[model samples]
Target: MPILKFPPIESADEQGIVAIGGDLHVESLKLAYKKGIFPWPISEDYPLAWFSPNPRAVFDLNNIHIPKKLKKFINNCSYKITYNTAFERVIRKARDIHQNSIHGTWITEEVIAAYIQLFREGHAYSVEVWEDKELIGGLYGVCFGKFINGESMFHIKDNASKIALLSILSNIKRADIKYFDTQMITNVTGSLGAIEIERPDFLDYVANTTAEKEINFQNFSLHLDFDL
Candidate 1:
């Protein structure tokens, strides 16, 4: 495992890039999250670039929205969900699925190894969605105290990724998490109730705040009201 170093978050350019060229070691990755920075590699050809975008995208736990159709899908579908049970698989699937959707993937082999180690040390978690005993959808990201930085997600079946998300939100209380961050706003996340807030606000939420998982993941379950 390589060590990672980053410049101060305040040093990030207008584009939110703070620094470059560090491998994603567990220590460095944890440090990055603590300081409101995350890596978004420019290309496989380039070194890792860290970012903490201003007007950061996040889901206000009090204002999260579950689209009607996805709610209906959850109500009608027969599927199983688990957390931290298959971290490596979930991350890899998210990476590959993302790669197919776009031209390239940022989940490089180095990134994968880094996150897998993070998971081992309990600095990361993943949500896995399964259909008929086959993995269909999942997502993974870093967990820093009361805040979570959602990295990526993918689904082979309609609404699979949404189900994974619901599982996370529904258990926030048990997890003691205060905010769920998507890192970047997109049509998908925006539809699912994510919003952009100033980086300082995000810093306030994560800085020095602490909330490790208090409940066993096996004991966690999604009890949906779906905000009809």
Candidate 2:
């Protein structure tokens, strides 16, 4: 059976490895996210690892910064953005993109299978950008209670993922969820307003945040506004 609990968040090393050697079963994943942790497979040496990083990277919904040029492009773009659609396709594309990149990839077949199960269980979702009815760019993540932890994103065209991110942020803000966890900062996310907060503050936020009913991303549609 998958372990239902993990080590105390404070026990994590400077690298933020709270625990190692747990299966990515839905029950375990759900518990990990509740305590502000998530899985990261480091290498073949470690089957699976759980992490809760200090100075957690996150986006403040009220302060998301979109470049002016990107905003203009977003306003004029013909792409269609949809939520909870083509999730498998999105993650697979993200995997392929990573696998071919210089950085390699962490989304192994095992990881994909596990997250696909999570998606089926309604704890994960994808936001896709379609152009000419062809999938071009997208992102995926796990959502529990009011917390959304972005996993990865891919784009076949310029600024496509940015559009999807802005759309999700707008909708999430409207739903009253004020933060989006990015785990670690990347150039893409950092340029888009992801900031770091102390681990304890992040845990406290997660502890106080909960939703009796899940936000239905399926009913969500794209908003054309670029003022976000």
lDDT per model vs. reference: 0.78, 0.86
lDDT of 2 by residue, 116-218 (tens): 9999998999999999989999999998777887899999998888888888888888888879999999999999999999999999888767443687786
TM-score of each: 0.91, 0.96
Per-residue error at 1 for model 2, in Å? Answer: 2.3
lDDT of 1: 0.78
Off by over 4 Å in 2: none
lDDT of 1 by residue, 153-189 (tens): 8899998888788677667645556578889888878
Q: What TM-score does candidate 2 reach?
A: 0.96
Worst 10 residues of 1 by lDDT: 208-217
Assess candidate 1 and give its TM-score to the true structure. 0.91
> Which pairs of residues collide in candidate 1?
none
**What C-alpha root-mean-square deviation, in Å, does candidate 2 show against the real structure?**
1.3
- Candidate 1's displacement at residue 208, Å, is 3.4
